[model samples]
Target: MVRADARENRARILEVARQALAEDGGTSMNQIAQRAGVGPGTLYRNYPTREALVLAVYQLDLDRLIDAVPAYLESHPPVEALRGWTTELVDAMRRKHGLGDALSPGLHQSITERSYGPVIGAITRLLDAGKAAGAIRPDADPRDFLQLTGALWRAAALPEDRSQPMLDLILDGLTAGTGRRTP
Candidate 1:
């Protein structure tokens, strides 16, 4: 069984690593250990390698996002909830991309492979809620939404952050009554 202190240490390390990496992806393991208030031995014990730690940090972020769906749905209307959630997802994707050359190709592949299914499931939940609320089109597919939004995060490096406005348009298209009409 993982002891309470061991779990706390691991959580603290993850939190510190997440912040440190976001601020600067080049942050070192020793630096993360120091910042986390844990010894290098403790840090290594929890995450045997820098790559493992980074992967853990990323997975934790993704899990946090997935876990947030219920709260977002409870707090906002369907469309608004989807908007807020997708906005955050875009930001997360931007940050993941921001890791850029720091992440090895294998790491990139690993992250993408691990993230896709859960992300789609989360989108499915959000879409289901919107459908249940009668706000989104019955024909809307989560995969299509995911494919479209893929471009939003890819555009993050642009001088102008035009994602939100573009997202607004996408949401409008997804709105129940807005499907194309007969000519």
Candidate 2:
């Protein structure tokens, strides 16, 4: 088990690394350690390598997103919850792409395996809720929704303003005949 101080240092390191990665998409262990206010030795003891550190950061981000589904559902109507979550998911995909080129192939594979299921489940829940609430077409498939989102994220070339229109299109397609008009 990790001691309290070690856990704190690890959290601090991840926090610093996440910001550095967001700002530049490239950062060194020494830079992370300095920014975290932890010594190099402490950072190494926690992460051992850049890939490990990055993987940890990615996992933490995914966990927060996956875990927020329930709260989003409780706090917003089903369609609104799905809309907000999709926006967040798109941002996460952007960050993931920013870091993807830097991770080792093995780490990338591990990330895929670790991250896909929770994301799929969260999205499926939102889709299910939307359908049950009559905010989405009864036949709207979660797998199809996933595919559509994947395509959008992969496009990467779409202008920011245009992407929302595309998202609105998808939402409209999914909600047609269900009485949920795009807002």
Candidate 3:
């Protein structure tokens, strides 16, 4: 077990790393250490590499996304809950693009698959609820919806400005036509 001070230092390092990565695309270890008021060695001791730090930041964001789901569902209609979650996901993807740009593609893929499971599960529950309530088509597969949303993020990450219109189009498709599930 880590000492209380060590745990505190680790938490502070992660927080500073996340802030730095968000504000500056390619966050340097020295910069993160400076922001956390820690020495470079301390940052390295806590997180051995830049990829580790990036993965930690992604996991932190994923935790927030997972925790928000139940609250969103309780407070909003099924369709509204799904929409709110999608919006949050888009914002997360924007942040992810910044962080992943600095890391290896393999590392990014591994981290995303590991950290995104809970997020996907939350979305699945929301989609299932929406379909059951007849707010969404019963034939709508949650996985397909998620894949489409991810595609939107990828499109938004493009050099061009396609996010808004693409998101609008996706939202329209999600709610297109009647709620009837074709036999």
TM-score of 2: 0.88
Query: Candidate 2: which stretches are off by over 4 Å?
Result: 154-159, 178-183
List pairs with backbone clashes in candidate 1.
none
* lDDT scores of the candidates, listed in order: 0.88, 0.82, 0.80
| Model 2, span 28-103: residue lDDT tens | 8898899999999999988998888989989889988998999999999988898888877877777777775557
Off by over 4 Å in 1: 176-183
Question: Tens digits of per-residue lDDT for model 1 on 1-183?
Answer: 999999999999999988888888899999999999999999998889887988998899899999999999999999999999998899888778776645888998999999999999989999999888889887788999989888889765589978988998899899948344568
Model 3 clash pairs are: none
Q: Provide the RMSD of all predictions against the true structure, rounded to 1 decimal.
A: 1.8, 3.6, 2.8
Candidate 2 has an lDDT of 0.82
Greater-TM-score candidate between 1 and 2 = 1
TM-score, one value per model: 0.91, 0.88, 0.83
lDDT of 3 by residue, 1-183 (tens): 889999999889988888888888676899999989999999998789888888888888888888998898999998888888888887787788877456689887887788666777887888788877777766666677777777777776789957667767766666676565458
